[model samples]
Target: MEFNTKPDVVVIGELNVDIILNQIDAFPEIGKEILAQGMNITLGSSSAIFASNLCTLGSGVAFIGKIGKDSFASVVLESLNSKSVDTSHVIQSETVNTGATIVLNYDQDRAMVTYPGAMEDLRIEDIDFGFLSTARHLHFSSIFLQPGICEHLPELFSKAKSLGLTTSLDPQWDPAEKWEVDLSNLLPALDIFLPNKAEFLLLTGTSSMEEGIAMIKEIAPNLTLVIKDGSNGAYGWNYGKLVHQPAFLNTDVIDCIGAGDSFNAGFIHEFLKGSLLKKCLKTGALTGAVSTTRPGGTGAFDSVEGVSKIAAENFKMTL
Candidate 1:
C-alpha cells in the first residue's frame, strides 16, 4: 500500500468559478434589471482556495474533486496549477457542468447564488485512497455542497487516518440548516476540526462557542478545534486547553470573500510544519487578514514573498 508521499496536504472537496459583480447599483429584482460597475470571473470554491493559498504559502499541496470538461474546468485547473498545486487527482466529468457562484458584492457584505453542478457529484467512490496516502495530511471543506460525499465521507477520513494521514475539516455553512452529519463517527476520525463561530454554534446546536467546544470535546477531547470569528479573531481548543489568537486587522479591505479559506490555508501550512498551536492560530489569523486586503480570496496570497511582505508591512508581523 505504498503511495506517493510528496505532498504536504491533500484537499478533496468542491470546485467552481465565481462570477463577481461589484458596485451593483441595486439588487436584481424579479422583473427589473440592475447595473454593476465591475465583474470578474475567478476560481471560486473554498477547497480550491485553501489548496491554492496553501501552495502559495509554501506547502506541497494537491487537490481532489470533480469538475466538468468545459471552459470553466480549464479556469479551475489553470488557477490551481499556476499556484503549484497538483491537479492530477481532479476528476473532469463530461456528464455534468462545472459549478459556479454569482456574487454581488456590496461593501463588506454580499449576496451569492451558486450552481452546485459537478460539486454535488463527487462521491466516496470517486476518491482515490492511494492518492490519500500520498499526502501527509488531508483537509476537506464545504460538506453541504456535496451530497454524495456528505454521508459516507467518514469512510474516506477513516481511510486517511488508517493510512497515517492527519485530517482537518471545515464544515462550511449548510444551506439546509439540517447539520445532519453524524459527528460521533466523524470526530473520532478527525484530528482537527475548523469551523467558524456561527458554523460551530449551529453544528453543535449550542448557543455559545464555549458550549459548542464543550459538546465536541465531550466526544473527542483530544481533537484540535479552531473556530474562526470575523473581527474578534480565532479560538482554538487542544489538549483540554483553550487558546485565543486575535485577528490582524485590515482597516482597508477590498472584500472578505475567501477569508476563512485563507485562514485554513495558513493554519494548515503552519500545522504541517509542526509549529506551536498558538503560532498556527496567529498565522491563520494573519493570513485571513491578508486575504481582505485584496479583492478575492487568493489575491493576497499570490506568492510567499508577497504574503510575507504584506504580513510585515500591514500587520507588522512575519509569516
Candidate 2:
C-alpha cells in the first residue's frame, strides 16, 4: 500500500519478542533457579522500538525488518500495528524462528540475552527499497549483530543518500569480535552515529569519550556523533561543536530496556522539526528519563504532549 505522503522515518533492522523478568535481585548462578516478582512480554527490538517511538512522537514511520512466522512474530506484528507504525516492508520467514530476548531487570539495571534467529536472516534481498525511497529519514540499528545486513551497508547507505534520505545508525556491539567491515568506510555514509559509551569505546578503541570523538572526526568530520552514558546523560559532537546534556533526574527507576531507543526517537523528532542540536539533546534526555519511569518502551508517553509535560515538569531541561 502506498501512503499519500512519504513517512518521516523508516527503520530497518532487527525485530524481536522481549520477555521481561522483573524485580530480580541478581543474576542466577549456572544451573540454579530464581523467582521473579513479575514477568511480562513485550514487542521490542532496536529498530522496532525506534520506529514505534517516532510514530508516538507524531512522525509517520515505516519499519522494514524480518520476523519468523511464529506466535512471537504475530505478537510483534500486532503490537506494531496497534502503535500505528506501517509494517508493509516486513518480511515473514517460514523456516526461521522469530528473534527473542530474555531481559532480567533489577532495580534500574538490566541484563539481556538475545537469540538472533530470524533477525540474522535480514539481508539486502529482503529489503524492499520501494518503502525506503518514500522515507525522509532512514534509521539502521543493530547492524553489527546482523551479519547479512552489514555486508550491504555501503550500498544501502549510498542508495539512500542518492535518494536524498537522511541516514542514521545505532551500532550494536559485535559479541564475537567479528566486525570485519572497516567502519571508516561506513561512517562517511551515515549522517548520525548513535553509540553508547561502551559501543563507542569498542568501535574506536578509544580509552575515553574525548578520544573516541576525536578519532571519529578524523574519519568522518561532518558526521554527528552522539554517545549515550547511562545516568550521566548524553554527549554530542556535531560539526566541531560539542554539546553535553545531563540526564533527567529520576528518583525512581523502573526499567531501562528501551531508554536509548526512546532517546533516539526524541532526537530524531526534534532534528526533523529543525530544532537546534542542544534542544534535540534535551528532548532526547527527557525521552530517556521518562522511559525509565515506565515498565516498557512504547508505553512511556501516550502523546507528544505527554512527552512535553515530562520534559517541563520532570526533566526541566534548560536551553
Candidate 3:
C-alpha cells in the first residue's frame, strides 16, 4: 500500500487540446462573423491542466485519460511530457477522434465549445486499479463531459477510497444543464469537492453560498468543500468552519483559461504536503492568479522558480 517511488498524484479524467481565440472585437451574431486578433493551440482539459501544473509545482504526477491517436493527441502527450508528467497510463483510441475545445476569449472571461470525442468514451472499466495503486492521491474532473464514467463516479470514488488513496473531484460545468450527478452518493467517498461558485450553485440547487454549504454539509458533513469564486476569492468549508482566501488580483491578465484548474493544482499540491487549509487556499489563489498572466493554463507554469518569480513580481507574493 506504500508507494514510495510512485507518483504523488494520479489524475483520472478528460483530455483534449484547446484552440484559444483571443482579442475579439465583438460577440458573434447569428449571421455576422467576428475577427479574433490572437490564437494559440495548447493542451486542454481540467484534469490534464491540473496534472501538468501540479507536476510543474514539484509533484510527481501521472495522467490517465482517453485521447485519439491523432495529431491533437500528440499535442496532449507532448504538452504533458513537456511538464514531466507521466503519460504511460493514457489510453489512445484508433476509431475515436481526440477531443478539442474552441475557446473565445474576451479579456477576463471566455466562452467554450467542446467536442467530447474520446473523452466521452472513457468508461470506468478502462481504469487500471493496479496503476492507480501507484499514486498517493486521485483527482478527477469534468464529470459532465465524460458520460461513460459519470454515472459510476460514486462507485469509482468508493473503490479509490477502499484502496487507501485520498480523492478529489472537480465537477466542471454541465453543458446539458441537467446537473445530474448523485451528490449524496458521491460526496461521502470523496475527500475534497472543488467547484466554482456557479457550478456549486447549480449542482447544489441553492440560491446562495450559505444555503449550498448547508445542503452539502447535510449530505457529507466530513467532506471538504472548496468553492472557487473568481475575482472575489475562494471559500473553503473544512473542520465545520468556513474560510475565505481572496483572489490575488491580476489587472494585466492575458486570459482566464485554466485558472481554476491551476487553483486546484496548487491546493492539492499543498494539501498533499500537509499544509494548513489557509495556506492551501492561499497557494491556490496565487497559482490561479499566476495562470492568468500567460496565454494558457500551462504557459505560466513552466517551472516552480519561474512561477515564484511571477508571483513575486506580478502579485507581490513569494511562492
Candidate 4:
C-alpha cells in the first residue's frame, strides 16, 4: 500500500506471534504434561492487533516496532501487511530473535508465557520523530514487555504531544507483578489511558474501581480513563462522571484473545474521527464482542463489511 497523505494513527510498541493451544484437557503440573485439541499461530501483540483492526476500520495506520529477521518476523510482517497496516518503519534486527507468546487457552480465559526478544530492544532512540509527526494520533502498548522503552515513555508521549499528536497508552500486564511505571510523569502527557479492571487496580494501588478512579482524578485530572471490564463491558470517565457501556454478549465465545486491543482499536478509531465519548465506548464494546466471535484477534475483523455484518448479525447492532 502507498500513502499520499499522513496516516491517521502511528502505533509504536512491541510485536510478536502467538502460539495458541486451546481445549486443553487439564492444567499442566510440574511432573505431568497436558494435551491440547486445537492449535494456531498468528500475529500476537497488543500494538499489532490494535493497528490491524484500526486499519480495517478505515483508519490509515502505520507501525513502528522492532522484530528479528526470522520466520516469526515474516509472520508478523505479513499479518500487518495483510491488514494494510504500513510496516515500513518496522526495524529488522539480525542479532535478536522475534518475540513469541505461548498461550494455553481454556474457554474465555487463558494463561500465557512470553519471550520478549526484539521487543525488548526497542528504545526511545529508535523512534523517528519525522515519521511520527506525520500522524494525528499516537498509540503505544505493552509497557512492561519493553523495558528499554519503558522508562522513556514519558519523553515519548511528551514529544508526540509537542508535535501536535494525540496520544494513548495501553499498559498491558506487568508480568513481574511490580508495576514500576511512574504514572505521575506519564499520565499527564497522555490523552487517553487504557487499562483493564485488574490492571487499573494494581496501577492505582487501590482495592476497588472507585478508589482507582478517585486516584486518577487527582493525578491526571484531564486524562480520559477507559477501563475494560470483561463481560461487564467498559467504563469511561466523562466530565469526571463514570459512564458505563455494557458488553455485547456472545454466548458462543471462541476465545478472548486480543479483545481488549480490538476495543482500543474501535475506541481510538472513533475518537480520531471526533466522535463522542459514548459512541467510542459503545463501538469499543461492540468490537470487543466481535473479537470473541472468531478464533483470534484479527479473525472477525477481516474487512469493514464483515465487521459490520458481525455487528448486525451477532449483536443486533448496525454499524
State the lDDT of candidate 3 residue by residue for 1-319, as single tens digits.
1234689899999998989898999987899998999998988888888999999999999888999999999999988888888888899998899999998989777898889899999989999999888789999999988998998989988998898899999999988899987789889999999999999999988899999998988889989999999888899998789999999999888878799999999999999999988999999999999999997778899999999999999988988
Candidate 2 backbone clash number: 0
User: Which residue pairs clash within candidate 4?
Assistant: none
The number of the candidate with the highest TM-score is: 1
10 residues in a row with least lDDT, candidate 1: 1-10
Regions of model 3 farther than 4 Å from truth:
1-4, 21-39, 104-112
Q: Measured by C-alpha RMSD in angstroms, how accurate is candidate 1?
A: 2.6
RMSD of 2: 2.9
- Model 2, 1-319: lDDT tens per residue? 3456678988998999989899886678899888899988889787888888888889999888899998998889988887788887788998899999998988867888999899898899887787688788988999766887887897898889888899899987677865555778898888988989898888887798888888888999989888999899999899898889998878888868689999999999988998888888888888888888777787776677776676667667431
Off by over 4 Å in 4: 21-39, 104-112
| Cα shift from native, residue 243, model 1 (Å) | 1.0
lDDT of 4 by residue, 169-280 (tens): 9999998999877778989999999999999999888899998888888879999999999999999995698899999998899889799999999999999889988999
What number of clashing residue pairs does each candidate have, in the order they appear?
0, 0, 0, 0
Q: Estimate the overall C-alpha local distance difference test score of candidate 1.
A: 0.90
Instruction: Point out the higher-scoring one by TM-score: 3 or 4.
Output: 4
Q: What is the TM-score of each candidate against the true structure?
A: 0.94, 0.89, 0.91, 0.93
Instruction: Give lDDT: candidate 3, residue 310.
Output: 96
